[model samples]
Target: MARSAKAVPWFLFAAGGTVIAFILPVMIFITGIAPAIGLFGDALSYETMHAFVGNWLIKLILLGIIVLAAWHAAHRLRVCAHDFGIRADGAVSIVVYGLAAIASAATVVALLMI
Candidate 1:
């Protein structure tokens, strides 16, 4: 019997997440529109920034982004190692996932702390 391979959403979720995360931030900075589009406008203060990000909506957004980003990093690292001709799939996956786990944990913790 032959084994069949199926596409995984996690792979896309991770790759897409990483690309989107970096691109979104850069685009925001370049366009200088995030500030105006964000919760604060005209005069953005530390308090305003904190308050805005502290909202549930912001929390949800951050969580969504970070969760996906972490997953994306894990998958990308695997692909990178594979591309580099690394044959240790188990070790590679473990290391990649470890990074993702740590990053995801930190992101969630940081959000809750704030």
Candidate 2:
């Protein structure tokens, strides 16, 4: 009965992909487009937005989104490389996952500092 450790990254990738596909666009529109089109007014103002992000719950959600998305992209890249005839999966995994780890760490630090 061997356990497959690969399930962990695959899980993150799937969850991240789902979030990015479903939520990211709405987020982008709210944050980017709505403001530009004057739809949100002060909802996206600096003070209000800062306050929203400063909440612990919001911080956690943002952290999850950022980290999971990074992991998702990394795993996708690794798969694409494999599909393209790249054979060094171990090295590719280390590189891409390492970058994701770095990005996740940076996201945490940035969120904490905000």
Off by over 4 Å in 2: 1-3
Residue lDDT tens for model 1, 11-112: 556566766767668746733765656744544666766787799888988777666766776777787898999999789878877787788888889888
Each model's RMSD to truth, in Å? 4.7, 1.6
lDDT of 1 at 58: 84
Clashes of 1: 1
User: Each prediction's TM-score against the native?
Assistant: 0.70, 0.92
Q: What lDDT, from 0 to 1, does candidate 1 have? A: 0.72
**Residue 29 lDDT, candidate 2, scale 0-100:** 95
Q: Which run of 10 residues does model 1 get worst, by summed lDDT?
A: 3-12
Q: In terms of TM-score, how similar is model 2 to the real structure?
A: 0.92
